[model samples]
Target: MSYFKEDFKYDLTSSIVVFLVALPLCLGIALASEAPLISGLISGIIGGIIIGFFSKSSLSVSGPAAGLVVIVLDNVEALGGYEPFLVAVSLAGLLQLILGFAKAGIIGLYFPTSVIRGMLAAIGLILILKQIPHLVGFDSDAFGEMEFFQADGNNTFSAIIASLENFNNGSFVIGIICLGLLVLWESKYIKGVKALKQIPGSVLAVAIGLILNQIFISSGSALAIGKEHLVSIPILSGEGGLTAALKFPDFSAFSNYQTYVTTITLAIVASLETLLSIEAVDKLDPHKRHTPKNAELKAQGIGNFVSGLIGGLPITAVIVRSSANLDSGAKTKMSAIMHGIWLLLAVAFFPTFMNQIPLASLAAILIVVGWKLTKPSIYKKLLAVGQQQFIPFVVTILAILFTDLLIGIIIGLVVGIFYILRANYKVPYNYSTGEFKTDDGREAIKIELSEHVSFLNKARLQTTLDGLPNGCHVMIDGSRSKEIEFDAMEVIEEFRINAPERDIVVSVKDLPGGKGRMA
Candidate 1:
């Protein structure tokens, strides 16, 4: 079908873009998890191919999420080994499957819009800050952790200073060249070059880095990508094949309480992150595609399930990869599948070439990604949404920046709920008699208005109307009312227009400050 053909073309483009972006992220997340570097790539491949097959989301890309880094690291250390932790991961996947089937995916709907937006903005800022050191040729062990400070005694700001102090000239030069090429590729000057436009900035950066690395090697210079900054996949000789890389879960650890706790924690965190990313990716879709939340949860569950069985980290719908996919013109889920295929082929056939790509160049690509997510325009738009929305939004941003994602979202939710309650408390009417006579000898609802009514009373009025019986003549005793709020008056006026449909009659008593007849 024409639809299928068009989708395939889009998928190919998206797959290439996401593949380039995902390759580095998989390694970075693995480093953060304190697991074998190969674990991250395996998760990425499984997430893309396996999750893609099951996912109802056409545009979302799945991978190991940065948000789970701290937990993953803690669990790995606590469990004594990555192999034992696989047991917990399998349990986590099962729990996620339960959550999806139970319709718990709807939990994302309860998050205040302001909080979600603020979270996104804060995450963008964090990504930019964290990637800066790498972009400038620093290869510290603390690559993907979200903490402002590193375990190596370097805070975010201090890390920048450190990178500047010990910057590697060779790596820095390569990074600058790559960054310049990326910027040029994105510029309007190249807009007319359709062929060039199809090439992803990330791909261009990698290609240039590879070329520069060859040049350094040929010149016998000390400016090559070191093992510290390259992906380290274990190469098995003597009858191992792909199975040699696979690690299985140790079910013997399931007896421990810590295993259960970690499993539940991973499930909850992974599910929430996936749901949030799915929402974001759908929003970013140029075609305005809608992704099914429940289905996405199931797909992530399946991905994590397979990942655990094969000794890989749990997977989630990752925003960075999904964003890259959208920006690369991904039109369907096939792009995600193609990305997985690329990862498989790269690892299986071109590990040597992939290992040569500089981490600095990939870091540069991520820097651009971080900037796009945290643009100044985001702040301006938040302000324009008004204080009622902006206050929670700002609080969420600050909380996320100062603390972590979970705590930040909690604080924002509490603040948002407080505002909602405060708004609800402003209503002015109180019920008087429980029963009143109707023309047909039935009880008529009686509402006694306070001295004044206001916009905040909208909920109370709506509640009263919702509870009223059909064919009831509601008596609103406003004789004692001092003033009617404009919003309340508007509600009454609108009701007057459609009162017949509801079979209700509204009789307003004496006007508060005037000698007017009851209406």
Candidate 2:
């Protein structure tokens, strides 16, 4: 009620927008997953309403994720049936439940900020590229999968080329018209209209596309849009009869070794995707509210369990839908919930209306969404952060574009680790030249150790100590140090014991007690 009182209007309006954005994506991701289209819609409904209710996040939208398409497809092929795969998804949900209780979501903390940004940017670029073919009326390929290679036997770039070779003039015309209308809808004038603001631009663009498609067909033009170019959603036979769509997992398959392997793989990948999307969504939140990681994992786990029981793909928090919700001015989780309601209704009652919509019109809307992700400001900011951050960010983008998401993330992490170690490998001790009077009026130089000294600092320390003037008194202090690696301590002790050879009187301060060493 509080949400209704405070943000119901905004949430409801944004829900329709998200529902529009999510509809085609759900179908496209399902196509890429090689799963039944109904499975994708079921996951979307469960993800939004079920998971959104349980999650504390204000803006994270969950669904059948593009990141899992390859994994799901491969698993399906290996498992030999969709039912067995459903069992794996259910087991994965249980695994996520255990992980949530165990606080395994803490692993999200280790992903570097640069890598996360890189991931989002790469997805954005992929969105733009993947939609190009669709925008040209090339309906053979799927949209929103975000993989380097597509299900239509084409890679990202090759699809664009093929679309050039095979494209419909009507779809191209519709795409431009829809894109123009979308641009205008975001303008100040259109936004000024209260009623117009309530109706999302995507919905309008789709309506126009439907009309244009009808006109083209009626005119008997060569450029008329065909059935293949339009959306196709299976209509329900009747109301509240979900029994036909519901699919139960074959629990008997649990004994198979491959089942556990697929289950574990799904859990791990789904968890990573969820954590990453949550991180990205937080960045997009206007209120700057933080989501509880473990709670989100548990919510997703519960949703996947239900979705799996009813014949759905594994669910994860999805960044693209979350971003669209944020930009559309959603204020609460209710928007995500309502979007699910809309999806269910569309499938059950309004599928005929949905089927008339053109894919090119949807592509035009996502093109705008994709542009939002790879804004010039983002790249400029990353560049200003320096090479350590920018390199991993760019490397991640290239890796994801060339390989798969998981492999890309792994490569980005490796690069981030390299930067982390490079930063830490420098000397730890502070070198401040201070002259002190010894008992006999000799000048002594003192060096204080930092909290922890690793062997990586050995070279600099050796250089400084070796360059010290002969016959000078030197004090090597470690009183404040919590740890000193053996190799580093060796350098200090060697300097201490070899003092006479260099005609230098060396004294050790707070040297750690140990078994016999040269004193």
Q: Give the TM-score (vs. native) of candidate 1.
A: 0.81
Give a tens-digit lDDT track for model 1, residues 451-501.
777777777786676777877777777777777877777776666556668
Regions of model 1 farther than 4 Å from truth: 1-4, 241-245, 426-519
Against the hidden true structure, what lDDT does model 1 obtain?
Answer: 0.78
| lDDT per residue as tens, model 2, 469-506 | 98777777787889999988898887877878978877
Tell me how far the alpha carbon of residue 129 in candidate 1 is from the true structure, in angstroms, after superposition. Answer: 1.3
TM-score per candidate: 0.81, 0.89
RMSD of each: 8.7, 3.5
